[model samples]
Target: MSTPKPATEATIRANRAVRDALPFDDTTDIENADRGLIVRATGQILTDEGDVAWDFDRWSFLDGEAPDTVNPSLWRQSQLVSKAGIYQVADGIYQARGFDLSVQSYIRGEKGWIVVDPSISVEPTKRGYDLVCEHVEDLPVTAVIHTHSHIDHYGGVRALVTDEAVASGDVRIIAPVDFLEESVSENVMLGNAMARRKAYMYGEIVGYGPDRAVGAGLGQVTSAGTVTLIPPTDIISETGTELTVDGVRIVFQHTPGAEAPAELCFYLPDHKALCGAEIVTHTMHNLYTLRGAKIRDSLIWSKHLHEMLQLFGDAEVLFSSHHWPTWGNAELRDLIASQRDTYRYLHDETVRLANKGLTPVEIGEQVNLPDALAQKFSSRGYYGSTNHNVKSTYVYYLGWFDANPANLHPLEPTDSAPRYVEYMGGADAVLERARDDFEKGNYRWVAEVLNHVIFADPENTAARELQADTFEQLGYQAENGTWRNFYLTGAMELRDGIRKQHVLVTASADSVRAMSVSMFLDYIAMRLKAPEAVGLSAKFAVVLPDIDERYVLELGNGVLNHHPGTADDVEATLTFDRSVLDGVVLGTTDIAEAVERGDVSVEGDAHTVRSFVQLLEKFEFWFDIVTP
Candidate 1:
């Protein structure tokens, strides 16, 4: 494998100019980040197996100024989130930062502590909780509040509270309505595909270094540990719902569809601290996350910010799930309003441009942030940039269509590439021309033209090498961390190909068990091979005796449909535990073994059962990307 290249002179010039463009001399964010005195981790956070879960020591290179290879603005943002310790945001509120992508907060109640949004995994949150006990107070947790449905906010729940504790009413698990459905079903439904995309989005394999992995705009990195989830006991549905748990008066503002599908914000009346719940972070949050999930509602997100200010404008301190807290009412409100207006601007301008017959890509190129917003460090595109957000906003209203006949119904890349290459004087001519463009600091165009040759003939080693080099330079110049990660990771893959070891863990036993029977069936139906199942007709009456529910699975004309209640004249009647099907999907328990052991009992047409199983496709987890 070839070594990574140094930043080109063009990249160096671009990075140098970032210092002058942004107010790097101002130390307000630096001052605010280091406001509270606390002990940094300064060592490895090791699990029981002596394996390191999080290593601040590895990322210690972030302690100083930005290098020429990195975007100065992003480096500054990374430094703020890289600080690890227990910080006292207010009198009774404390936060554990830098353990993972998301931070966990501890609110001291009259009885014990109420933990908010634990980090992504067990070891990190456990480390965070231990820090709370050692540094803040040694109090048993009274409650665990999940501010949103994202796993990063609530996945490490078992670390703070157990099932017995929650069951016995010793601890209360609180969250927004439909939290379980949102967190488990949606994430697990597309687990494999999203896991692959996640690798590129975060550049997880592209670990910490001076030239790489400088924080993802949200935080330093995600933790590699066990992810677990527990259902919520208390659900907040409507806005302005007040709950006094252990003598702490908290007002919950339900912000569904703002960031995550199910999310909420809470304000402490006594402490005057408002938890934004990933709604407003230190940087511009993603309206359209590159991991290929649903598009977030920027209008609703801005409205929620407006509502937060109206409800908690007097908040002395404002903290979010990611990044550090903002102190003082003025500063906190300004941050909220700035982020709010940023989205509003994206929404309004995109729609305005579309009405004038402009498309998403065209509008994206034209939209510009006002000097006031562009100058603010918080409003910079360290995570979410105006360019992509404009496209997201336009698609939110007008969809992906650009209204041009040439754009609509275009040929797929694979089919069109050879034709494009032929028209451009073949592979050699394109590569020769692209090399000249690359030398001229025109990497964007070089990458575009070189891709046609790669797609036309993937065996073209010359094309792959040039494209990889182009992608590396683009990554070096990117200010947005996700964009940089995607570019750099793609470049690495082009050079060395995909390595399967770093796959993200998207589903677990806890999350799978939380899914409804219907939700699981829905995913199974999606996995049916339409080509294999064409002209096939079968029906299975699935009786889950443990859950005491009956479901009908009907297959016809290449479509698998699930219906509730009994179906007349079914091909076979099957009775088994839901666990059996889950095991089959997760590759834990074989269908044949379950049948042999009498775990699954078939009433009639056993041959149909075998045939139906054959039709269900096992998804390929390591499907190709950056290639056909």
Candidate 2:
């Protein structure tokens, strides 16, 4: 196994210039982060059993000067996000920061506290609220505002409010329209694969350190705790939707198709504050998240920000779910304008270049944020890189194909690796030249060539080690935290095998039950083994009595098709509550137990459903990456 190395001379010089170019004199963010700190946490948050779930103490290392192993700009951002505490944002507004990847805000209402975008997990969010009670006022949660459908924004719903409370109207859950569908589908259908990629994205394999996971650019990292969800009671459908919850007149600006598929920002007219949610954060957010998702519309993103100015330009304070708040109307407008311009530049220039026959990769390579926009700290590539954002913009309009016939039919990495290696004078010859380039700080070229050698021969020790070293250098130089994590985690996997033995990110039990019967059936369709179904046909009626819905499942031509209501000549009619099915699928109740316990009943020959189950394949989450 190889060890992580220090920054090379070339990397050090480049990083030094970055430090010089950025505005170090500006301390507005630093002041805002510490402005309302009640008690700066210097300890750990514990679970029910007194076991540590989140340790604020360990990240105290961020107080030190930037190391050679980290981008100074990222280090600065990390330090700002590392300040964990309960802070007063205004006379009635409070924020609990650094408990998780997202901030949880509390707006003092006439009756009780209205929580906004609770953190990622139960323990942390519960702890954050408890702290608020101890330091501030102890009040019941009147409402929960899920500003978006992202997991980090609303996964902690059950921590603050329950389904019973929501049902009784004692606790009102607010979210954008399509929040439930987006939240459930995003976490369930592609859960395992996205979760695996998210491990690298969040630097889970690589622990936090000066040289390792400094920050997420927006925040430090996610809470490794129990995730929960409760459906929203009040859905904001259109822009200009106003809700006067406990005396705070909140005006909503629906920003769907911008950041999350369902996202919105709100303004407190009385407080003169605007909660930007995840749409407008301290850094440029991912246009296309590496964990896998549909490409976000940058054009729409810019439009929303422009709309924010028109609607909430007079907002005295601008608070977001991730980073610290910006005070003063002037600074708030300026920040919004800069963020707006930065994304607009990415959208416009990428399209302009694509029209001139530049491919996505070509455009990404040449495109740079103008100095006017790049100088602003918020517009910097701390989370989302300008390069990747540019590429994503091109793909957003045109799509994955670059229009070149050769590119359109390019060979898969495995299929072409051996030939590429053979053409490049074999493995040893390539490694010999790669070593020279690595010494000369040509890490990117070395990485590209070495990947072919690695794919051609996984057991080649020299090639793997060189690739690991190459990735480490790239990680050290990356300003984007996600990029750093991907590079370093890839390096770690090359040196040591994948860390798949750990807990995987999956949809919660509540999420599973909350999913519409149609969506759950869609997930079932994804699990169908196409090859097993080929030339074999099966039909079944999935009857969910709880939802008063029946869906017909059909398997033919290696594809599983499904729809609402009944179908003619179905082989089996499987009747079960959505709850019982959730328990069975989540492995809490086995199929035998469910049948014996009378949780699920079947008619019209159970053999059809049994054979259909056999045709479905269980996904193995621990598949290879950075290897064949």
Best by TM-score: 1
Whole-model lDDT values for every prediction: 0.86, 0.86
Please write out the lDDT profile of model 1 over residues 1-628, one tens digit for every residue: 4577898888888888888888888888888888774667767776676666777777778767788778888888888888888888889998898888998998999999999998888899998899889987899999999998988988788898999999999999999999999998667888888888888888876655766667788987777777889989999999999999877999999999978999999999999999999989878888888877888888999999999999999999998899889999899999999999998888888888999998888888899999889999888888888998889888888788888999889999999999999999999999999998888889989988988899899889999999999998888888899988888888878888877764447687788888888888887788788888886798889999988999899888988788789987898998998888778656687676677678899999988787776677767776777766
| Clashing residue pairs in candidate 2 (N, C-alpha, C atoms within 3 angstroms) | none
Question: What number of backbone clashes does candidate 1 have, counting pairs of residues 3 or more apart or in separate chains?
Answer: 0
lDDT of 2: 0.86
Report the lDDT tens digits of candidate 2 across residue range 511-602. 78778777767777777788877867878888888879898988788788888989878887888887876864465655545655667787
Q: Determine the backbone clash count of candidate 2.
A: 0
